[model samples]
Target: MKFEILQFPLAKSAYGGIILPMEEENKSEIFQSPTQYESRLSRPKNQFAPKKIFIILFSIVIVGLIIFGTTRFFAGGKSEQNSEPAPTAEAFPTDIPEPTEEISPTQEPKKPTPTKIPTPKPTVNPVDKTTGLDRSNLSIHVLNGSGAGRASKKASDFLESLGYNVIQIGNAENFNYEKTTIQIKSAKEEFLSLLKKDLSSNYSLGTTSADLASDSRPDTIVIVGKE
Candidate 1:
């Protein structure tokens, strides 16, 4: 194998030259100083190191933000669950009502009415129309057959009060006669019947006898007798 040398110019003014083989020229270009070698190696690493540190810090910040957001969401839900409404108070009455009194109704009393009284009626005496003799126009003779004192006089006065004309007043001939006898000289039986109402219950009618004289005989002779 043949070796060859190559010359290289140092400078334009210096005509000296140094020769080196091709392999030696290549070894010089490839070798470096330690400080320069360290500086060259670290410069490439420092340039990419800034990008890796920035990427790692960015990832950590994103994870911290996600954890903080998740924790805040759960805490807000728990706060909402614990909240509740407060109880209301009851109201009481302040004033009480008063009692009232009862009253009764008033009434008035009623008065009684006056009663009516009836008046008495007057009594009337009977009259006869067949004979023209009434109580006002009849002729009468009062006789006392009884032994009672003043009987003829009392009878005469009583007959006069009844509007009768008493012509005679005397005692009977026989006091032993029990019933009174009315001797009628005239044929007027109605006058004798009318006069019997005023006489006693023991009286009877009889015809006038011929023994009685005509002048002494009345129309009706009343003979008093004991009853």
Candidate 2:
């Protein structure tokens, strides 16, 4: 007689084991042709896609310019409206010429009194080695400071109250107030920072320290003569 059966039943399906699905070999139906299998595996979209960064940036710039132009146009219109003087009722002339109003020597046609224009306040020269405060002055940064909190107005007001005329306010920060020796603007080579350097060549700027924090507030910068 033949040996008793020692084999077990076949696996129903394979999910994630080392052995792959043997459906092709085990199934009774015919397997797909190599050509058909290759066709199925091939995807229509094979090439990598490129980004449209240039087009996106160009569109953004165009939109920003449009907004800026619209804003400026509206602002310009508003300014022009304010510039025109409204016609006054007295501007209308009578249809019939009335007797000419006699002007006595004592009284004359009221000429609009010209408003007194304020003279440009002189800028105080920095006590540093610079000589004068002119377009040549080389201030690295100008602060638009007012002291913060309760002490905010203290610094600026105190300086002004002391008869100190601040030419430009600086941003609130502790930084070298003087321009660096390096030239930034080529056209300004002959002016501003250069002029200040030449003029103040005789002066000495004292050393800066932690204790030397600016005594001014926001929107106020103090310039004093060198000690």
Candidate 3:
């Protein structure tokens, strides 16, 4: 009693054979969807992940900077912010003006006393016309202040270096600076000229050009000359 499946031959069969019916065969099941298609349609998304990570990193950096700044600000030992002083317009002044101060009485200013210049006694001699030979205050007579002519400049330089004031007087080139000689025509003529000059300035220069060369003075004559 062995049972086996039999199949029946159709057209072109050499002989008829036994065949199994469709209802007698068993069937296997299959999935409703394709695995590859399902997997592709349900794939995971990654687009916003990097953006989220960057946002998080940026937020962390900002927080870190803020924390670092705050920590340094306190540890650096800086003074606390101070409240502003009250404005003068808002605060009452400690010093107040009185009614008398506002209405100060008007008064006249006193006149300055006149200063009296001392009256000089009349002197026979007059003031001499003088000029400073150099930058020094020492003055000399004549249109040209030096008697040594241009040579007087050297004498002036020597006198200035010696800290002495020197002024030379002459109508013409009368003194030879190299020789230190007065080429005067006469002692009398020189004396008279000096006398007249001394009388004019209340200053006496000399009797002769030689007399004025050195610091010398005629005691009787108010005008004196430096020999």
- Where model 2 places Cα greater than 4 Å from the true spot, the runs are 1-51, 86-227
* TM-scores for the candidates: 0.35, 0.21, 0.19
TM-score of model number 3: 0.19
**2 or 3, which is superior by lDDT?**
2
| Candidate 3: regions farther than 4 A off | 1-30, 35-47, 78-227
* Candidate 1 to truth, TM: 0.35
lDDT, candidate 1, at 222: 66
lDDT of 2 at 181: 20
lDDT (tens digit, per residue) of candidate 3 on 1-227: 99998756433212353333333233112212356558867999766678899999999999999999999898665444344454675666587666663433685556899999998644322223352122233333322222433433443343334333345533433231222222122322333443343234422233334334333321111112222
Q: What does each candidate score in C-alpha RMSD?
A: 32.1, 44.0, 19.8
Q: Using lDDT as the measure, which candidate wins?
A: 1
lDDT of 2 by residue, 55-99 (tens): 788899999999999999999999999999998766676598779
Candidate 2 achieves a global lDDT of 0.44
Cα error of candidate 1 at position 210, Å: 12
Question: After TM-score superposition, what is the CA distance of residue 82 in candidate 1 from its true location, in Å?
Answer: 99
Error of 1 at 17 (Å): 99
Error of 1 at 157 (Å): 2.6
- Against the reference, the lDDT scores of all candidates come to 0.62, 0.44, 0.40
